[model samples]
Target chain A: MRSRSCIDERAARKAQPALRKVGRGASGRGHGNAVPLPGPASGRRDQRRGMPPMMRWETRDEICELVLADEPCNEIGTHMLEALERFVAEARKLPARALVIRSEVRSGFSAGADLRELYAGILTRPREEHVPALRSFLDRIHAVMDALDTLPMTTIGAVHGVCFGGGFELALTCDLLVADRTARFGFPELRLGLIPGFGGIPRLRREVGNAVVRDLLLTGRTINAKKAATLGFVSQVVAPGEATDVARRMAAQAARFDRDAAVTAKAFLKPLPREELAREKEHFVRLFQNPCVTEALRRFVESKDVRPYLP
Target chain B: MSDTVTRLMALAARRFKADAAKLRAEADFFETLGIDSVQALELLSELELEFDVEIPDYELQGVKTFTALAERIDKRR
Candidate 1:
């Protein structure tokens, strides 16, 4: 096993593992003359303090935990989405046997996209502008999700309470899901009149079957971890706060096998079809462009009310 | 305050689209900007690119105010 010693917070704070390309030292060519001002969270020059990173990578014993700091609850904003993709790429570039995705957020794995941003940006824009903006946004997001899906390494989603909408959609991309018993899993997107744009529907269909997906997607109700386990939504349903540790253990075991053989086996189990995935994106875009859907999203934002879909 | 600190604060105010004079050095980022985790990360990313310094997410996890942000950036520099 590849073992790693604990990274001292004081010392670790000084290193920028993700940005080594920029070059590190007492003085760099850019961002001239930064004075040492250690705050609650250590930061490189050119940043404000007292805020948490949306996501971080911690590598040890050949396993990397991409943690979503609690302060943020791992919400995926446009920038957060891009950062996640970048971080994944960097981790893949590094030598790691397995990847475990989890969150340290007290509330849950992630709260999904920023509703404030979504409502503010989408509502203010004119109706004609909605389709183009949404199309580009969906296209970019689909790329990020595709990045996670395409990783050669095994990935696990360690889920806890309140994984809804985009967060739930994200967890579906993982090869294995180890959910906490108290976890709540659901797609609340119907409330916003938008269907899953990041391949959630297809993944759910494959994992839980069409009937189950229909029930969950149509009703917009979340299931507890136990129910999800029985329904095959999760492989392991452990006690509260044990999701991340269990996932790590599982990743270690997976990493123990011959890397090539494991990868080949994974490829065999789910050979993702590019054509189908592309179709999924198109479907989301078309539906979002529909007048009814746009009107619903706008109404939801303006009134903060949920009007049940009649169709 | 150092020039670096003043500039960093100003940059943050602009990114958050808030009034520079109104932003307190000690205010929590989420509270002051009314932005979520992802937006905050975007601000960090913007700063990194703008100043050409690397601010790892782990290092900025506890930062919530202008003062802490300046301190964190200073340490990295």
Candidate 2:
């Protein structure tokens, strides 16, 4: 079988000159001078003149940074998702044997879907307009997850602080996860009267177990990193500031293996069958009939404590 | 090295920069090559498929280098 690593390496090498040209241009412009021009202009410049500002590659380590540097309130906006997709695609082309992906946020990894956008879409727009917009947003999120899943290289998710909803789902797609002891993880979509539309339920079920997945989806409660590690959701729990280092170490070790075999094995261990997915969808449709789900939603909306059953 | 091992090692070195040429028969997998836990798990997953052997998570942290990994594979063989 052809080695995926070789294919990636070749592609990266072929693209190196273009990448370097962009790097030179960005450096020449001076970071401070690169104001947030109009979105279209900045985006065009990013595509034509160099790499996107949010993504950076460390060739020797086979690591990439997907930073969520926009203000915390801007979480899960259209621009962020676009940047994530672009970075993930570019990272897949890098020659590295394995890849380590870490969030660049200090306080929280990500705040899940942008609530402002959601509220505005539902309240101000017609259902026809709102549903398609929501679906498009979900599709973009799925694209990011799919890219992470399909990358031939082994991928590590190094998380800290808070990783909620879509951010949590993104981490679930990784082959391995490393988190700080105090990091928080959860699927808060239920509080908004919605499901985790970005592949969270299926992926979480595959990683942890069906029972835990049920509780999380039904209750939308957050869990600490230690608890996540204990439940086998997190692969490793490190000291507060050590998640990235641990992830890098893990990536470096994984890089030693035959990349083709790695890719094949990951593909082999994918989630349950299509029939099973359909059955799960049916159950989800009936979720409103369940007293537990309804009560949980009520309590979540009423500002009552619902933490006990969330994990 | 066997052809299979040689090719695999070359791929690893090229991608990981682990200096396969410097690997000794008894070297520790992670210690010698700076393999962290996540990378070790990924390597374990790859090895399991390549050799059709189940190298459990508990055993993954113990193996440190390609040479040691080869010995383990040899034993499994």
Candidate 3:
């Protein structure tokens, strides 16, 4: 029989190499210099400057940055979509046993579509170009989310502040979501006179009940972490500053298991049926036809200067 | 000496290792060898199936080493 002391010593030995890999000082390359700024601070500055934050990779299987940062409006553009796709692809290839995803923004995980990009696409591009551009962007976004979902590993979303629109969809694709007490989650696309174009509607409905998904999406209302947990949207809700730690712990635990089973299990549990997906597509078409959506689009157009729209 | 544990571990090690030299003892979890969280979870899932145990999220957060995890599995068994 293995004595407890012997087990503890073996565990420590097994864990030591991984721990050493964890706290390695940030490499001073690329945007790693930006590490000094907290996620919120960087987000705010990027918002002011009107540019997307440079996505940065840390040593211990973590990715941070505001994807759309300061871009034209709050809309995700082709460039940003490509960057995200690349990140997801690269992350899938990393040697880590699990992956943790977090945001740099303080009040909003992502404010949905970049309005400036949308406005530009609408105003400058021909009417015929609109659908193709939108579809292309959606496809790329779907690829990223799909990669996150099907990667042969454990994925955890460490959510704090606000997770809305596309950000909410991103979190939903993760295997687990660990949210901070201050975390706010929602799908306000309907209020904007649009549906969640990037797979948010079906994923949200599958995560929470249809009722909660209906209430949140149709009303464009926000739910706090506690409420989200009650509705089964959030896996765990920690103190405001504790999300990263909790995510790390979860990642650490995931690191100890077998990879094939994890991938197979995830593939098996995906809840979106073809019928539901078809219905969601119809909902998107109807939502774009609504006057509420038109007015919401107008509001989105007008709100360009408002720092970050906290959910 | 369950075939399940040995097979699961072998698969995990093969997926995680970049070179032949990296594979270590059964006690060496992938994380210690520079395996990321996603890879770790992939490994965990195999163990979950072999042991028929649902690893709770909280316990998942606490696992740091293979020996610690193996013991946890042993207890459940």
lDDT of 2 by residue, A187-216 (tens): 766654456656667778887778887766
Better of 2 and 3 by lDDT: 2
Runs in model 2 deviating more than 4 A are A1-57, A271-311, B1-77
DockQ for every model comes to 0.01, 0.01, 0.01
Whole-model lDDT per candidate: 0.61, 0.54, 0.52
lDDT per residue (tens digit) for residues A5-45 in model 3: 10111112111111011111111001000000001111222
Best by lDDT: 1
lDDT of 1 by residue, A165-215 (tens): 678878887889998754666676665556666677777776887888877
RMSD of 1: 17.8
lDDT of 2 at B27: 57
- Model 1, chain B: what is the TM-score? 0.85
Per-residue lDDT over B1-77 for candidate 2, one digit per residue giving the tens place of the 0 to 100 score: 66556655765565458777875545555556554332333344345445655432233334555665666666665
lDDT of 1 at A254: 88
Span of 10 residues, lowest total lDDT, candidate 1 chain A? A28-37
**Per-residue lDDT value at A190 in model 1:** 63
Tell me how far the alpha carbon of residue A138 in candidate 2 is from the true structure, in angstroms, after superposition.
2.2
The positional error of residue A104 in candidate 3, measured at the CA in angstroms, is: 1.9
